[model samples]
Target: MSNEHTTITESLAKVATRANELCNTVDAQIDNIKNTLKAEQDALQAKKTQFDAQAASSISQYQGKMDDFIESGDNRYQKALSKGDVIVPVNLKHLDDSKFYPVTLYHCKMLDVRVERYVHDDVSGGGILDYFVQLQNWSNGGDFTFAKQFHHSYSGRAFVGKISAASTPYTSSIWLRGGWSYKFYLNGHYSKGPVVIESETQVVERIASTDYFLAPITEVQPHVAANNFILGV
Candidate 1:
């Protein structure tokens, strides 16, 4: 009986030792699985950060390129057309004097408008104009009378030999240079008549430019108004 009890006790001790080893193995495997999951999570975070940085860089570059393209277009336009021209017949309509006239240039906002002149001449009914290279109105004066106004000193009185035009609805061109010299053309014909701007002083004093090249002219723009002024092109 003692011998049998010793053998059984020995067998029971070995079984317990095997069970402990299996539990230890299971615990180690669980720890390894947690470490592997942590590593994958860390890798994913790192990759996400890298992707975000790359996307931001690409967006910045695209914006920069767009800005450069717009600037380049402006430069090209300025170089091509030293003299500004607008087709008046394409852009005008007659309106009553009591109503306000509006002119838009280069898509810039005016926000507000104030009149500069209100001359009740026979033709334009009453002419209106703003000071400062923004357009004014004098369309009613017709061709001959309106042309006279361009060179006049704007003193509310008539002056002598006021740089007049031969006809109405004539095409006028101004060099619109830094010095403000202007040249005139009639109709579509570029080569027909003498380019009568009269004097450089007359051109510079009356015709002008803003900080920007193009100016605005309203529908009430005079047939007598310089051709460039008529179109505001």
Candidate 2:
């Protein structure tokens, strides 16, 4: 009986040891699985954070572009409402006597004139005496009405004259709503018969009353010590 009891006790001890070893193996496997899962979770979370930051930056850039486009459109609209359409100058010398000068004016309230007179160096006897430029509007076929006139005198080598409606009443500001065609006629003569002369006329469209104020101030000082600054006509 004692031998049977010892054998049974030994067998029970072996069973307990086997059970402990199985439990330890299972615990180690569970720990390894947990670590793997945790590492995968951390990697996924990092990728998610990077994607979120990139998305936010892209959204911000797109919003800024949209705002700039809107502002640019608004600025263009305001400028169109405030400013007048520019009228390009036409050279009268190029046009023939049969053809009348044609110009389109949109919201034109004032007219700006620039006349340049250049005399040849070889010109000795004759010089520019009385020079006048007239603006005539003939929207009604043959009948024409004078709009503005600029009278200037040139004597020396080269002369440049600028005349505005504000300074001279003869070249006063005129309002034209609808598009109208205007003609420029230059009536001038020289002292000693026909002399080589070059002349140009420019008409600028003004939208506001203070448009003339924006012109650049040109200082014209006479060479003579006693004479003051000569104001060009």
Q: Residue by residue across 17-55, what tens digits does model 1's lDDT show?
A: 999999999999999999999999999999999999999
On lDDT, the candidate that comes out on top is: 2
CA RMSD of all predictions: 17.0, 17.6
Q: Which stretches of candidate 1 lie over 4 Å from their true place?
A: 75-233
- With candidate 2 superimposed using the best TM-score fit, by how many Å does residue 2's alpha carbon deviate from the native? 3.1
* CA lDDT of each prediction against the hidden true structure: 0.34, 0.37
Stretches of candidate 2 above 4 Å error?
73-233
> Model 2, residue 212: what's the lDDT?
21
Q: What is the lDDT of residue 144 in candidate 1?
A: 30
- Give the per-residue lDDT digits (tens) of candidate 2, residues 1-233: 99999999999999999999999999999999999999999999999999999999999999988998787887754343233342222333433322222222222132223232234322443233222333332222133333343444455421222222222211222221111122222222111111111211333323346222112122322321111222443
Q: Count the backbone clashes (under 3 Å) in each candidate.
A: 7, 0
Error of 1 at 198 (Å): 47
lDDT of 1: 0.34
